[model samples]
Target: MDAIQKSMLEKIADLHEVPEGAYNIRSNGALAGRNTTANIDIVTKQDKPGIDIIIKPGTKNESVHIPVILSESGLNDCVYNDFYIGEGADVVIVAGCGIHNCGTDTSEHDGIHTFFIGKNAKVKYIEKHYGEGDGTGEKILNPTTIVHIDEGGYMEMETTQIKGVDSTIRDTQADLKDGASLVIKEKIMTHGNQTAETNFVVNLDGVDSSANVISRSVAKDSSKQVFNSKICGNNKCYGHTECDAILMDNGHVNAVPSLEANDLDASLIHEAAIGKIAGEQLIKLMTLGLTEHEAEEQIINGFMK
Candidate 1:
């Protein structure tokens, strides 16, 4: 696949072609294409690089597309992907990664993903990360996600990083049981001297377990952003966490949300908001003529959609 790896797979997994049932595509550090159907199964992890996605028992409308692409120069790629959703399954998973560094040294990728969602399973996971060229080296990404949900399980995760990456670190962890439920949504954008970090830890052990975490970020030039969240409720649980950030030139943002409740009908909540970009929303989009950098890029693309 040329044309800069199919335009980095249509900006991370909105593939223009070659997508149906189960799929795996990786470039610059191995396997370029693969497919498996009939209730989905794609294996190849003889104790090494990546791939093992299996969804069988009572599988419904199925889907899987693992996407990773890096364009050679000074490559450092690492991966270990795993997902098993069985009992009463309903599935959809589209993983995404893209990088195309032109020269001068650093282009790194590290991904470790694991999810096992079983009894009464329902899973929807979508991820997107992107980077581009005009190189002078660095475009580094580090991602790690782990989730386990069992009795009456349900999981939903959506993550997006829509900008040329210079450095990123994102890690997520979750565990839930009886009447389990977990949901996470994160969107991030960073500009020039870019650096971003997000970390989340959620544990709602049993008895009507529930969790929700959300983060939205936009930091422009001279960027630096960090958000950390933690939610823990042992039994009879419910948890919530949210962080929102937006900043402009010479931007920097730091947010922390934390919560823990041991029992006694546990319920937890946390929220944070950082400011910038609302001088009457750039004078109401410059009286509908749109100039302040196109009304702050249309309010940061409608607040990252």
Candidate 2:
């Protein structure tokens, strides 16, 4: 691996070597890599910006990793990845994008991922976005995700943007069938003059289907964040959405959570809260011999995790 690739892998996956039985994709024009596994088929489309991953039926305990690295600045990369999960398959995907820019120009990555999960399948998807540079350049990411779950299928998605990203706009939508469920957890922290906005829409279209969307964020040092989530239920289903944020030092946050029920048997709920750090919580940590800064750091870490 080159210096840029190694740095990105370490920061995103924290691995010295790729896993033994996992498929890997590096977005900087490197060839896609995959292990010798019969449970999944990995294919690279000749005319597209992303790969196609198909999990075999009855497969279990499979994992896939897709990470992007950008070594230069003033570059924009857009990718469209698709996943097809077969019936009765259980799989996990770890995907993220990291940029290492040292120039005075901006670098951006726009990724659009779609998933089609078959009946009785389960999928867990996790993605993290990170940017690191010392120059006066901006690192931006715009991600759009769409998920479709068949009857009796389940999907859980987690996305995080810890720091160093200058701006981001994320959009996600999911539709659930009968006896299906969808859960999404989003975590973000921004400092300096960074800004982020996220929107989520989920539809429960069948009986006994459920959807839950949650977001936790921290903004500091003149940063700004906005979160909007809406859930709609069309049948005998359940839905909930929540957004919680912490603001510090001139930071701003706006949260709008909404719910819609078209059927009498549908149930939906939403909650949102944005505030500063609690003084009592900090004082309690300080009494245990931790400095104020350390206490605050600990609390932030715990909260983000």
lDDT of each: 0.91, 0.87
Model 1 segments more than 4 A misplaced: 6-21, 24-34, 37-54, 58-63, 66-85, 88-92, 97-126, 129-151, 154-158, 164-178, 183-185, 190-207, 221-236, 244-246, 250-266, 275-305
Q: Model 1: per-residue lDDT, tens digit, 47-155? A: 8999889899889888899999999878999999999999989988999899999898898889899999999899999999999998799989899999999998898
Q: Per the 3 Å backbone cut-off, how many clashing residue pairs does candidate 1 have?
A: 0
Report the C-alpha displacement of residue 234, candidate 2, in angstroms. 1.1
Give the local distance difference test score of model 1: 0.91
Reference-based lDDT, residue 102, model 2: 83
Q: Could you tell me how far off, in angstroms, the CA of residue 217 lies in candidate 1 after the best superposition? A: 1.4
**What value does the lDDT take at residue 139 in candidate 2?**
93
Please report the candidate that would top lDDT against the real structure: 1
Q: Which portions of model 2 miss their true places by more than 4 Å?
A: 29-32
Candidate 1, position 302, lDDT: 93
